[model samples]
Target: MKNTLLLLFSLFFYTMSLNAQFQKATAPVADKKEHWRNIHDDKVLDNYYWMYDYFGKGPDSTKVVDYLKAENAYLDATMSETKAFQTDLFTEMKARIKEKDESVPVFKNGYYYYSRTEDGKQYYKYCRKKGTLDAKEEILLDVDQLAEGHSYYAATGFEVSEDNKLMAYGVDLVSRRQYIIYVKNLETGEILKDAILNTEGDPCWANDNKTIFYTSKNPVTLLSEKIQRHTLGTEPSTDVLVYEEKDKSNYIGVGKSKNNKYIFIVSNATMSSEWRMIDASKPNDSFRMFQPRMKDVLYDVTPLADKFLIRTNKDGAKNFKLMECPLGKTEAANWKEVIPVRKDVLLQGVEEFKDFIVINERKDGLVKLRIRSLKDKAEHYLDFGEPAYAANFGANPEYNSTNLRYSYTSLTTPSSVYDYQMVTKVKTLKKQQEVLGGYNSTDYVTERLYATAKDGTKVPISLVYKKGIKKDGNAPLLLYGYGSYGASMDASFTSTRLSLLNRGFVYAIAHIRGGQEMGRQWYEDGKLMKKINTFTDFIDCGKFLVAEKYTSTKHLYAMGGSAGGLLMGAVANMAPDLWHGIIAQVPFVDVVNTMLDESIPLTTNEFDEWGNPKNKDAYFYMKSYSPYENVEKKKYPNMLVTTGLHDSQVQYFEPSKWVAKLRDMKTDQNILLLHTNMEYGHGGASGRFDYLKDVALNFAFLFTLEGISK
Candidate 1:
């Protein structure tokens, strides 16, 4: 026995010596850069496997945990070195905008207006009476001093009566579900009459201006019903059911004809929408379906003397085309196509003028306006090259008899309102939103680039940064993106982003799939079974930025909200090494669980967007990418997960349970902070300043992660 024990001891000692020697040999030669590259490549291969493999048979929990720990370590180190970079960025931004005034909305002369002030507390001048700074600023309504009950409550859809006697506004304070239609006496500042109506849909005023027609949904029946002829100064005299939509989709009241003869309604049941016309004169009448077989249809109908002017997608192209339809017709087939659809161009804003229809078209990313005469075959087109978006035709009050007004903006431009005379063919700028005094657009440059995804699909990315910025590879990058639904992330100007861009750090927007950046087809390529593409696309974007030496993986941070948050969570799991830090605000991370249950509100409608998980196919697909379900032992990066306790859209429990699960599974001791706002909803912040401060905090965290600042 003694001989055997001695032999075993000798063997153990020999084994220990060999292990120490092996550690010494491997430790110094690890080559962290090469090691990280191999790990990332392995993760990419694993992600492809996870996409196709059966949900129940996936990566082991231990493997996931190790990856997350590695990710956390990488982020922590990167954040430590770049703390000063972000501080410089924010400091420079504040210095640039120190002298500029903030802008606010004001209500005056029975119309809602805006005011800009160098200081936030004082109003400088009214928007309409700009250039007359010496004139005392007029106060139309003292919103703060108004009685609590009688005060306007979060008005959104504002419309003034024709005679300007009544101010009709929609308010929703308690719940976003219901909207209160309040008609107030403009002269007396008294609540003339208010009705609790369906706030989920838009509200329209009747031609007479005395009656209001709106759409509401009955929760019990789960049907969208129309409430017509709710007269002012009295209770609803008619409870006319214009149409009852049986599909569990949204139905909205567009508007009534100028003559108040017909009411137009649009119903989106699933991927497609249909337009219907109802005779307002016949209260008990059923709606006449205009285009039942139209796919991806969007139209704005305006009443004309004999025929109705219509803008629709009847043309085989993706852009809208102007057409004319006989009002008393029985079928949409009777409509005459006035403007043919063009293959390369997209018709945007359309409005009816005295004798012509003004149409805006998008050609090669530039916006041009064209006016077509209804009486003659004459057409006039105007080009304003600034990458204009969200163009709307507004009638000029001064030249209301002949000309129209157009408002548009781009990346560097603030909103500009322009008046165009149809008869004179001249355009004049009426008003331009001025950025606070010291802020300048010339300091930053905007560029568009494409990142190649795993499947070789080119994803568009918009980068905004200070000109002549160093390409040190250590520069901080805050990448933002949303890859869900058919929502398009468009190019628009933001004063708030100035706070980041001015700070030397680069800010980028990744236009991934699942968004309508390219079109509906693009969205479909990234949803459902293709959901993994969205996460992979984001990871590829980060990799591309690093590969191009624009920013190192250490200084790279990512952020997204709502559906975008879901993107952040998925990418965090798949390639945590690519990001130093992540911010997910009001995320829908608990996909499989939330989608499987129908009892949750808005579940039925969302099922069409995100497939019903009860089905075997959907269960496999959803479980594959569900962040909460896929959580395993991993080294996750420093993550700040935010949620609103009152968020009715994405339940608060999702983030709560997700954080708890992540805490249990994570192997690394990385910071995983959960900030829940008790008062806010899906937005997470309440007031404007409060939202800005929250944004600052997020930027602070990101900059800190990039070693920019504490």
Candidate 2:
């Protein structure tokens, strides 16, 4: 016992010596190479522009790599003290999840399809049962086995042929979002030779079973530019180019109707959409244009038995409305309003069934599922019974069935799946996420609060904490925000979040603008020239939390990813003192520079969302808040910035350059760590359990700042 104590004491001293060495180590200093650009008479200088040379394999490629490695090494040395804590957090969070779990099976076609994970596995196996739920199980794809040797592997677009004899799926080993479609003979258990590369990973199978359609992407820009149709057993080079999008700004894809009667080629931009349709049975026939692209009218067609239902923002329907047209008359002039535009409700989408239709509506930042009878036009909504919860349609593939599968969850409730009878209004709980190690909803408390923005707009904030926790200023709180692309940040439940709640941390989600939570106008008011509202909304929420005694400025932490990372960068620049620490994951921080480069992936496609910077007005507006451009010599909060080496959406150089500049300029000697995953992309690790490690590191960063060590 005395020797054990002596050994522990020696180990402690060794660790302390390493910590002291890391503290004395110098941070990596990025070289300053002058690069200037002038747009609309505005000239600017960029010192870190050379970081973008990595992808081009230019002279500075090795230098960029060496610099990134140095920063990573610096981060390792600085955070070496928290290494064991991060692993402990990972194990703690992973323990709450069921090792072997299966999804609730969904009845589709002639089989009940589901995916199940195995013990100690990082991926799942796709399985199905014939006819009845008790029938013999057939394994379609064992993703675990397929991903065995690959460091990063993603299998998506699982499209089974209408006959159920074959399956077509896309695989991405590079983690760049570019997938290669492969065909597998499910009945014979044989993999086919048909492989198509550089696709968007969306494989749409035609009714004939011998043909498939997929959207092809540009190799360099990674833009979905062409829809190609390939025949079974034929070389991919011989694939027919069915449709090619001329407008670089519009993103295009090919899909089939849920009823399997028609194949569609959809081209959509931020403000407009166009669609073309061809009979699924007639794969060789030319596609007929249902509607030509309009200036600002965005619409989508849902095929009904006798007519086509068009959900559109036509005729100034800001919140959108449902319009119907006769089977043969699909022109805009022939369309008649079935559901009028509501000022309070936003018609998010619709799911079509033979006898009924489900309308997904959002009002007051909450999702509402309204069932309408196609035969009688009667309508009713499914009750979720929670003020701040996320409810949405699940996998309801059978167009002839009356049952609607929907999922519901709140900040406190576990994700629950339910199948509701549209005719009888009866709902059956299919499954709720099994949080291993036990979890009780009553032990937690959730609240939906509104924080007034600087412009007087009421931004919604959803928060959750332990039941016994007091609303005092001493608690540590993490405020998460993602206000971009009209994607609503709903209050959803995750078992891993319990770790934070159990650790006396309050978690809050800021439903800021640039999202369609409130309404379409809410999004319009927060994007383009008004993009400042998103940053200010997040800052206001942080301040509001402090004012309400949920947390104080000293304990407040902020986190965001992708576009939300842009938010993190903005808020840090605009209001640094509001947060003690910040986490920006795969952040789109170099906005003006990224927007000006059309060759970059997603740059040309997001012109309407972020604005085209070539124009004089937009050039100035974007530069004003562009994180990397606006960074100045000032005190800033401790920040942990993460990026993937091969991120297709937002390049890794953005975060790398941003961090280098922050290190060079920031006055405060706060922790500024940059973690670049050398093997992953925008969405980090592909394995189910592997992502938890990153989460653990993030939580450890926050815990270290809060001085909470386990």
Cα TM-score of candidate 1: 0.75
Query: What local lDDT score does residue 488 receive in model 2, on the 0 to 100 scale?
Result: 96
TM-score per candidate, chains pooled = 0.75, 0.97
For lDDT, the strongest prediction is: 2
The Cα local distance difference test for each model comes to 0.62, 0.93
To one decimal, what is the Cα RMSD in angstroms of model 1 from the true structure?
11.2
Expressed as tens digits, the lDDT of each residue in 169-205 for candidate 1 is 6655543345566776756868764664654434666
- Candidate 2 lands at a TM-score of 0.97
Q: List model 2 lDDT by residue over 3-67, tens digit each.
A: 99999999567435423423445789999999998889888999999999997667899999899
